[model samples]
Target: MKLYPIKSGNFKLDGGAMFGVVPKSLWQKTNPADTNNMIDIAARCLLIEDGNKLILIDTGMGNKQSDKFFGYYYLWGNDSIDKSLEQYGFHRDDITDVFMTHLHFDHCGGSIQWNKNRTGYEPAFKNAHFWSNQDHWKWATQPNNREKASFLKENILPMEESGQLKFTDLPQTDMLKNSPLGFDIFFANGHTDKQMIPMIHYKGKTICFMADLLPTAGHLPLPFVMGYDTRPLLTLDEKEKFLKLAADNNYYLFLEHDAHNEIITVKQTDKGVRLNHVFTCNEIFN
Candidate 1:
């Protein structure tokens, strides 16, 4: 199996929102904010090439949204899914599975795109099967008021409408030992209901796709949960448990939203789990 870090795009978000109640004085040390209090973020997806299947985990926000809609996020950079895929001599059409960690626009938006005439939205990967779980499918489709904005209909629905949507069975417990995608999945609820964090065994190491569960290295602290999380307390528990496993097992965390830090590993420190080392995608994936 081969894994590649796919740089879909970059954008800036309010540092305060990204770090929740954590004081700017603290988070700023690791994730320095710009003059506008916006911190850099990356829609870093992952591509898995194993035998006949080429699975893509998450698609950054597509270019279908209106300028006014995108202006809010303050996007930056020219890195796109197409360009990133081409780097590996592949294309979006080569993706056999688009396994979303969640349905948030930044995570799954690129799964759909405007059709040729721009008449309506359609599945962006014509030959791929879009993967989501039943619980998250419902949570995203019938979103609550707080999360509805992040779960844009244009970014979703089209996969199902195109008859290419497939659901991963919800695990009997929080962690699914084996998934149809051929990886262990840890289901996290603090960020959003049933956000599946893929635990991929790669190159003799476990490379965990740390979705919103741990957005950035700055979020390693227990209380540094994102303000967007619906259940912050639940997040604290989940983080504590997961961080312990990560530290103990020496898992390589593949951060999806950390623009600066591509990958990291944590150590069981006196204070608790803390960042042990940082690695560029090239250093690890290459």
Candidate 2:
């Protein structure tokens, strides 16, 4: 199996919102912010190429939103989803599965796109089965007030409307059995319900796709939870458990939103699991 890092695009978000309860003096050291306190983040996705299946982990924010909507996030960067796929000599039609970590616009928006006429939306990956959990689907479709803005309907609904949507059963351990993808799904509820983090076993190394649960290496600390998380207390609990496992087992965390750092490993320091080392994906893959 081969894995490729697919960079969708880059966008700026309020650093304070990204790192809840964490002081600017602390987070700004790593993810420096602008005068407006917005920090640039990459909407990085992962692609898995197995024998017959080509699975894409997440779709970054697509270019379908109106200019007014995009004005807020300030999406900038030359690396697009198409360009990233072409780097690996593939196209959208080549994907067989689109496993969404959640239904947030930045995570699943690129799964759908505007039609030629701009009258309706269509599935971006025509040949891929878009995978989302049933509970997450319901929660996103009927979003609460706090998260309603992030769950855009244009980025969703089209998957099911196109008959390419498939819901994975909760606690997806059995779903990954004997799968050539060489990954186990770790479900956590802190950052939106049923966010699936793919724990991949490659060449005797375990690399986990740290979705919003651990957006960047700067978020390694226990209290660096996001304000967007519906349940911050649950996030603290989940992070403690996951960080312990990651440190003990020497798992390389593949950060999804970190622009500069691709992967990092943690060690059990006196201050708890702190970052031990940082490396690029290509370096480790090589």
The lDDT for every candidate, in the order shown, is 0.95, 0.89
| Count of clashing residue pairs in every prediction | 0, 0
TM-score, each model? 0.99, 0.96
TM-score of model number 2: 0.96
Judging by TM-score against the true structure, name the best candidate.
1
RMSD of 2: 1.8
lDDT of 1 at 93: 89
Tell me the tens digit of each residue's lDDT in model 1 across 31-66: 999999999999999999999999999999989999
For candidate 1, what is the lDDT?
0.95
lDDT at position 186, candidate 1: 98
Task: Write model 2 residue lDDT over 157-210, tens digit each, in one string.
Answer: 899999999976665431343233446877889989888888888778987889
In angstroms, give how far residue 211 of model 2 lies from its true place: 1.0
Alpha-carbon error at 9 in model 1, in Å? 0.4
